[model samples]
Target: MYVLEILWIVLFRFAPLPRIWAVCLIAINLGALFFLDTTYGLVALLAALTGIAVMMVIYSRLGFVRLLGIGHVFWIPMLIWFAASLPDRQTDPALYWWVVVLIGFNTVSLVIDAADVVRYLRGERAPHYRWRAT
Candidate 1:
């Protein structure tokens, strides 16, 4: 399940799809959070909000490269937290699946963002498409 979610995000990122489709995907992903355990779901939501806050701060103050670096840095501990929570799979399969899906998305996004940061550092001017672009 987690593997499929990761593949979906990676494929969607590169596919020539309309922006609305990406928005739909995000909506679906967020909607799925309701099925998760309350505590776990709230934690995930907070983490996401924190990530957004961090991105806005970094992007507004330091620019894109710094935003990417800070975002990836923030994700590292979240990744670790998800990994540490893997044992919950035995006790609560549903919550476990939710965490796995979140981990997959975060990991893929981090990788893509890291690649872009490296490209920028290397002086590459290749255009990158973001899902949120207008």
Candidate 2:
């Protein structure tokens, strides 16, 4: 799948920080899936899967460019969802911290994605990886 391939690229093709980020995101989402609160976990996964879907579509149209991060736009709603539902999840310490860390990490990621998208808009149009479009 493109998502795994993206993870691989981030892990191997990119530098250390991107590798750590890819792993961290995986850890966070997997934790959500394993959480006792199935509803909370599923909702969180829903937002993430939607973002992956968007990224897949964009990657299909364009190669592995900076714009791929545009999929993370879905995180905007997820963040809002987290804000609205955070108080309830507080009862679950693990899940609560998961949400908190997710918020901080994703907030930073969104900023980076936004900058990459802006750069893509500004004509930095070359593909990041040359291994074939997908």
Candidate 3:
């Protein structure tokens, strides 16, 4: 999971292939959710929808900068939930390692996202591609 997440992040950050990376990540996440227990999957889906709605409202009112500021707040509870759901380390070593990898991925994402928010708050414009100099 860590490797996969890192690959996705790298693709998004430096590969200049945002749409492909986004689609691949979305597909992978959906596949994972599909394999989860029905109740948990449904709850996660709902939470995702709620987060999108909240982000949309924030973007509409405060614009992209503020939205990025608080957009990743959901990760805190998600990390906790993932930790709490982890299987016993001794009895299920593979599952334990997988959960740890997921935690690491989320931690990295949280740090990066927070740094982006801080940069925005400090008046740095978000980076983007340019076809030619203005």
Candidate 4:
């Protein structure tokens, strides 16, 4: 199932038409809500997971100037939901702090992804920082 999810995401990434991919993404999210089927959720979860994996590969070679930021954008929300869902020994808070955390992370991720995209568009071979650790 995981492998299949990965294949689906890779296919989406390479899809020629942005509209097709967007439609597929929306359909999956809507199906998850309408049918209460976790399969669609699971697929989305897999996509987020793959984003991290792909980021790792890119970062290893190019260093993390932007990809990490983009990842945070997507990841923060998921992290917040997961955190808020946890049972506490004392009491459950009315406000979901986890959701806030997720939002923060997502925003950071978006910034980084955008930076990388811009750099790539400008044909940048190297980032501001040294690719290798000091």
Candidate 5:
């Protein structure tokens, strides 16, 4: 699909920094899934999957930096739930650390997305990259 091609180019070609960041984020999400049945792991994985679904929809209609907030908006409340239920959630050291990293990493990403959305609303509407069929 053109959206996939465009997303690939947007992340890999036009934006090397974002590419590296995306890889790291993917690693974190996948790493967190190692304990899928424990300590909020299922919810975390769901959030990641849901975020991906939302991101794909947003990407279909807008550029990466523009409406990126919509892709990440669900994460904040999930983080809050993670924090509120931390002590009660059954977690070992590994799962605990994964949750911590997931919270920290996604919080930073949400902040970045918020800023990007603002920039977009301020007229930075041009897409960073576009893919054309060869």
Candidate 6:
């Protein structure tokens, strides 16, 4: 559990990797059913994917990254869903660890991503975005 959280923090924080690549890896490796076997796991993965998909859709339509409340509008429901399903302490330690890993990773990543959006909205900086070839 400790190792998984540590790895999550490291991968999302310090790794010299693009955010999209990291998101893709997370969405597949952890978000996929094979890596998650608990009720909470399934819910979190589904919620995360849904939130991300919505964000992507908005980004595509709006052509800007800093829409007010957009980040919260997308993620708050998922956070609530995760909080509602927390397991009891007597649950298996292994499953508990998996939950922590997924929750911690998702929470930290969302916070970082939100900060970037806020900064963009504030005009402190421009949002980083990938250019698509037309």
lDDT of candidate 2?
0.78
Show model 3 residue runs off by greater than 4 Å. 1-25, 36-43, 61-66, 88-101, 125-134
lDDT digits (tens) for residues 1-134 of candidate 1: 32233234335654556344445435534744685556556665666656656655655444334234344456567668768766367877876776687677667767767876777778764334333344
In candidate 6, stretches whose alpha carbon ends up further than 4 angstroms from where it belongs are 1-32, 35-37, 62-77, 80-85, 88-90, 124-127, 132-134
Across 1-134, the per-residue lDDT of candidate 5 in tens digits comes to 64476457656675578888877877887885687777577777778778778877766777454775667788888899987766333537777777788888888888888998899889998766556423
* Candidate 3 lDDT by residue in tens digits, 11-117: 55445564564454345334436536543345445545555566556554554343343654665786688677866789756545655665665466567678877
Task: Please tell me which predicted candidate would have the highest TM-score against the true structure.
Answer: 2
> Which candidate number would show the highest lDDT if scored against the true structure?
2
The pairs that clash in candidate 3 are none
Per-candidate Cα lDDT values, in order, are: 0.57, 0.78, 0.53, 0.47, 0.73, 0.54
lDDT, candidate 2, 10-125, per-residue tens: 77787788778878876876676776455667777887888889888887778788898888888887888886777445466777778888788888889999999999999997
For candidate 4, the 10 contiguous residues with the lowest summed lDDT are 93-102
Scored by lDDT, model 6 comes in at: 0.54
Q: Can you rank all candidates by lDDT, best first?
A: 2, 5, 1, 6, 3, 4
Please list all clashing residue pairs in model 2, or write none if there are none. none
Q: How many clashes (backbone atoms < 3 Å, residues ≥3 apart in a chain or on different chains) does model 6 have?
A: 0
- Structural similarity to truth (TM-score) of each candidate: 0.57, 0.86, 0.55, 0.39, 0.80, 0.56
Output the TM-score of candidate 5. Answer: 0.80
Give RMSD to native, each candidate.
7.8, 2.5, 7.2, 13.5, 3.0, 8.3
Steric clash count of candidate 1: 0
TM-score of predicted model 3?
0.55
Off by over 4 Å in 4: 1-49, 64-91, 131-134
What are the per-residue Cα lDDT tens digits for candidate 4 across 7-48?
Answer: 444454434663464355434333324322333245335546
- Give the distance in Å from residue 132's predicted Cα in candidate 4 to where it truly belongs: 4.3
Task: Report the lDDT tens digits of candidate 6 across residue range 60-91.
Answer: 56543454225334445655665666556575
CA lDDT, candidate 3, residue 19: 55
